[model samples]
Target chain A: MLIGFVWLSLTKAGVPLDFSFLKDFSKRLGDGFWLTVALSLASLACSLLIGVACAAGQSAKILPLRYLCNIYVGLIRGTPLIMQIYLFFYIVGTAWGIENRFAAGVIILSVFEGAYITEIIRGSLLSIEAAQIEAAKAVGFTGRQTVRYVVLPQMVARTLPALTGQFASIIKDSSLLSIIAVTELTQTIREISATNFRLFECYFTLGVLYLCLTLPISFVSKWLERRYDYGN
Target chain B: MEIEFRSLSKQFEDHKDVLLPMDFAGDVHALAVIGPSGGGKSTLLRILGGLIAPTAGQVWIGGEKVCYEGAAVEAHRKKIGYVFQLGGLFKHMSAIDNIVTPLIRVHGFSKEQARARADELLGRFGLLTEANKKPAALSGGQQQRVAIARAISAKPKLLLLDEPTSALDPEYTTEVLGIIRELKEERLDFVIVTHEMGFARHACEKVLFLAEGQLLEYGDSDTIFQQPATYKLRSFLGKLLEWNI
Candidate 1:
């Protein structure tokens, strides 16, 4: 809504939102864009896996595994994502001699996002009625078979909206990795702005690009929610 | 097929017993488990279905002593099908897919065979037109019929029906009861838990009465209804009869 006013005000100030910088900016941010995309997807995949596992652990029949999952999620959610990222990168990353900063960045983002994802997955799974499980078991499904055939599919439908939010968070949070000199989108924007003195244009362009990346996520999530709603 | 419960009982964590120790042996194929609220009718069916384990004692299905959480129970489970009061058809799957899952996943049928079986059941239950609809799209009668189709697709020897008509209107209840009649004609053995004694009298040959998780009476339809032995059965019948009139 403020876009028209922003364009008008910037032009009036003699620092017009220029398209000439876009060519260079795109070229420079191209690798950074791909890197950001890669990191977001990588983190999402890792977080989903971790979330599913932790959900299983939280609902596990065994007492200890449930408690362990509880502690993991509680600790991750209790602290700030940025603090956790810095802690992971500085402490565990250095201790293990993780020379690859990209790997470290991906790891931290996934670990941070996983806490929220786990809650989503676990809540969805728990929402399933005991009658469903009884029906599955009555049909002679092994515990594993029931989870694979019945529980997981329903869980996907229930968690789609939350999963989409988590994915968007992963993408946005990847911007923070720029603090560690990860050369992701934000870092690229900073480098370009420093050289061209086009801070407003670069930052605005970055916001638009992020919006471009995130809008589809919202659309897809809505589509999935509607598709999977079978009126139960 | 025969079912024998030997000293089977269930106790919750609060040290309160849901099912006191009980023993029952029956040679009949179809047993109607009837009881008042909190009488453990559902629990008894669930225990027999292996959804819950008895705190103590053993359950013998077709002469095999079922060991809870062991291979024996798993083996027993494969031949038993359970239907819940609310259909329990997965909302994500259509009516056909709901039936197909048991045949393909549990009974190890090929995809084509599973589809064929699903179609057959859908037609038999008069749900052929609703095959593509999910549980939400179908009527109550259609949903419960589809659930029954899914349960029986695997050809389980024992089918457990838990409060089968509790949620249905009169027309849907008739439609569901009609399917049960068809199953009986096919000689499929089942234990049905129901409140509608008229339907139970028509569908089941024998009855098992449970109260406070104890077996109050086990008898033929005539004995349970006409010559009820226990005071619980007599009072329950009196209340049901009064309500019916």
Candidate 2:
């Protein structure tokens, strides 16, 4: 295949197909690896909270609250995530004088991913039948009770697969933080390749690391999709 | 319990009224609303169920004005159960979950109690084997049975069924109707909207004929079918009887 030919040619051209760079880079990557995982986990948690909150706000009866949520979601979704990150970092560091790049990355990723997750949650909520809500109301459930007990359980069950897939996407997207010198996996690999001129080995190791993180999530997502598919 | 609809009217913007102004009441075990499609039969049943507000006049439940025009209509709706045309079981839940949801969520029953109640009702409806299955996996008749079991799980005083058998095949229709007939024997009050005159005749104590948002005739099943009061009812019966003839 053409791919095999290219790969072999690249290996022969001193591209360092061996993955020995990963061990060397792992030492240099050091604190950054833990930092990157912490940043991703923190941002993902914030994203879920903000996403669920904004979804509930959007579905509120008050026009002003719903409109505000809509505008927030639109503004976040319309702009590129890279630009949003740069803007947040610049504004927070200069105007607010917040020196922490890690915090800035977490905040930016949360707001960005929150908008996408909000849409997913809202779609799942709306997919529930109107009759079910009516039946709940008929049985004397208050608006809050209906949503908390009746609607939310079904929404969570329906959207779990999509949420897991989104989490995987968020993990991949966390690599973008390297643009701000956050020294994540991608940045560490790039630094290693720049020093030893082992581009293929470094990138290959990075891809494997990403696979290690995302493949498990992908499998879990598929399993959840099968489990939640009440249609079966 | 007695319920009355007094001069109730409802209309959508730029559309003719779906329910014309009319006064009707029921103080019986079972009543059937029978008519051609889009004749406001469902609209009337909805008003009685307190799902939507009427554009004019009021509805009284147990001699209290529970619903009025342009007002928040809050009533003891738990006493009334409405079955939509196609079972309308929650697609996300298994049959037992669907049956137990209203009890646990609305009535604040403990999960153990709700599950016990669901099992009892599913057993009564002969759906214990299918209780773990979702509505989408069940046959039409089984889904409808689950829907009915869900509706009655709250032990409603009044049950309203909107074309419960409309989506089923003849065999399934008979199966579902047989379930309803059995419920009637247990003294459950029902307001059924049906096209099956045969079931109406055999099962309902009274039948009301509706046409173009107006009540055309009301009488016991035999009299309404054999000696229709109006030309509208006569033509309606003629059309329906022709199907059987």
TM-score of chain A of each: 0.91, 0.88
Deviation in angstroms for B213 in model 1? Answer: 2.0
Model 2 docking category: acceptable
lDDT of 2 by residue, B1-245 (tens): 57677888889687789988988787757788998889999888877777776788888766767753322443356667778788477777789988787788766789999999999988988999999888889999999998898888888878999999999999999999999999999999998999999988889989999999998888798999889889988898898878575
Which ten contiguous residues of candidate 2 chain B have the minimum total lDDT? B67-76
lDDT of 2 by residue, A52-97 (tens): 9999999999999999999999999999988987888887666898
Please give the lDDT score for candidate 2: 0.83
Writing each residue's lDDT as its tens digit, candidate 1 over A1-232 gives 5978987887788785675878866777888888899999999999899998998899889999999999999999999887887888888888999869899988888888888999998889888888777777777778898889888888888899779877888999999999788999999999999998988878988998898888998888888778777665
Top-scoring candidate (lDDT): 1
The prediction achieving the highest TM-score against the true structure is 2
lDDT of 1 by residue, B109-227 (tens): 99999999999989988889999988888888888999888888888878888988899999999999888878888889999999989877767899989988889898888778989
